[model samples]
Target chain A: MKMEALVHLVSAIYVVSVLLGTHGPVYGRLVSVNDKPDPKNAAATARWLVSQNSWGVLNTISSELGGAPFGNVVSFSDGEPGKGSGIPYFYLTTLDPTARNALKDHRASLTISEYPIGTCGKVDPENPTCAKITLTGKLKVANGGPKEEIFAKNALFSKHPEMKDWPKDHNFEFFKLDIEDIFLIDWFGGPKPLTVDQYLQAKL
Target chain B: MKMEALVHLVSAIYVVSVLLGTHGPVYGRLVSVNDKPDPKNAAATARWLVSQNSWGVLNTISSELGGAPFGNVVSFSDGEPGKGSGIPYFYLTTLDPTARNALKDHRASLTISEYPIGTCGKVDPENPTCAKITLTGKLKVANGGPKEEIFAKNALFSKHPEMKDWPKDHNFEFFKLDIEDIFLIDWFGGPKPLTVDQYLQAKL
Candidate 1:
């Protein structure tokens, strides 16, 4: 095949491979991208990191541990599939200290890394270019009304199907961060200057 | 080959493939493991998560962000390859908020997930059985003596080779979490009760 045609064929195959790798209901619905975003676009890049990542470390002030900042691994979603709203919602059980801690202090943060998405490749996780976002805010149980609960359920179950099958005895409740600050590091200089307004307004 | 020999051959091939995937000098040197420890061995399990993971979300009280628990993705090492001391050390630069946060407030935690180690298989990241560890303690700059710095260098550079070459202008320094509390979940029920003494004394 000619060079130009060969390049096109390779690109098509790559796209097909990605589609084939993403399987099951949870992986099937969401959009997955490995492209590194331009560091200049702080809001877009920040939202992109949050939307693309499936899980992150949820930080909470542990009253039981003498007020230490305790981070726990968790699966989260901003919305269902490609329709991310730039606000992360989680399904947590009080059995977990994260939920217990939040119940007491409410101060928390969710940190997501771009390295897991295969976009960073060889960059060190600590490297600023690898991209990490910490959404700092108040952690609270979602509104009990059907309107918000339904949205939270769809947002979580659509991305993490296993969560739906989790034992009902766990008393899993929907929790969300009332984002008060955004700290996003996507490039070398420092953390990106992103605000809650800019992040929520960014077009996916 | 006999049937038994063929089975062994296939297993060998699988192991070799894993080694090939984890590259670079640092990754090459570390003894990687994916087997989940028994929930009963809370201390060992906690140490295993720290030893096996090269990076995790380091949480700290962010003074700049109104004292919210700030979590940042960072590369860390507990000790040189196979000799993990159960104390997580980091190579942090003040350009990052985490290091800055630690400078002001020492209260912190390092959270790691077993999902990345490929042992959890199809389990959801947040599933209790998937295993997660949160070492809550004080984040402090390492002692400025040659003895400690050398150990920190060897431990860090051995697992994350790129760190040795990080820009000097960035002023990356060695830091370690003074683990005071251990919260580990390797199976169902809830967080395992593990003390700092138990974790530090656990046999690998």
Candidate 2:
């Protein structure tokens, strides 16, 4: 009986530790860039990459160039972070050919953000908090290998199950991004950049 | 004098036509990419590039992960559609090195969204509605050039004169991004991936 009790306590502590240790969603900013990749900045670069690929609310201005309103909640993803086997990857899905073409050109960036549900105000569109991390990076169609494709598909489906029934080639395509920078903004202040490693550490 | 008046009327008409025609903003969706730049899908690539260089709000989800929130405006100067001389660029200033590093690696894939006022929700920390378009692209640190540095300075100072007094190269740096893709979402659900040209034609 004592042994069983001890086992339960250990298990509980382990679970709590894991939960506490793993960082929640972190806000980041994209500040500067280098023409080529630098190993010395690997930690920062990695954190930005993860943040960019992660999910958040995406916004755009009106088309009339006048008083058009902003849009909300588009899906996005950043892959799992780590070295060697499981590096994080991110992607988005759109039916527009222009967007498709742009993604193919490796010209895409993202602002991954998180809010305390009520931070943005009421869930209504009229008044809401628009706090998030904007990650600037390039977008490329995921065309690596069967294994890579599988991983991409799984990652996407995990986030958005509604996409499961879509045609394999149609709504589904892998988008890999090299995180160039991150821009983090809280409603309290202004937007700024964050390093990839810092973002990752925040997540952890 | 009558002939001069006629000329003035013609010129006024032309000016009004241009204002009415080119007054609005463009919208579209960006493509996705990974580490290497993919050349196969040029259109998607372009959209992605536009998205990467854009700006948005930032939010924090956890404390363990050094998450901070901020809000800032980013400006872009892609040539006026027809003029091919200008590429898109924006201004970013932050004291965070992590954010700066992220912008450097994946400069190609970022998103910048633009929109009119009231398009976004109110500035309520809970509910907000601000409309704008986003672009994703690569970031380049300005190194005192006629074209690069000048453009960056002009855009930043024009919109944000408050920063004019900021120290040079301390916490502020002029950065230029080569847009790869762009995503413009009006939220009216008219059509996806609206081109800048198409948007102009619609106004006419």
Candidate 2's error at A72, in angstroms?
9.7
In candidate 1, position A47 carries an lDDT of: 80
Model 2 bad stretches (over 4 Å): A1-73, A79-98, A101-104, A115-131, A168-171, A186-193, A201-203, B1-204
Compared with the true structure, all predictions reach lDDT values of 0.81, 0.38
| Model 1 per-residue lDDT tens digits across residues B1-204 | 354554445445445544555333334223334454677888888888888888899999888877788898889998887888888899988977888889999999999998766566456788778789888888999996999999999999988888988999989999999988887889887888888888899988
TM-score of chain B of 2: 0.44
**Candidate 2 lDDT for residue A64:** 28
Error of 2 at B181 (Å): 16
**Per-residue alpha-carbon lDDT of candidate 2 for residues B26-56, written as tens digits (9 for 90 to 100):** 2221211242123233333333333333234
Ten-residue segment with the worst summed lDDT in candidate 2 chain A?
A119-128
Q: Give the TM-score of candidate 1.
A: 0.87
Q: What lDDT score is found at residue A153 in candidate 1?
A: 94
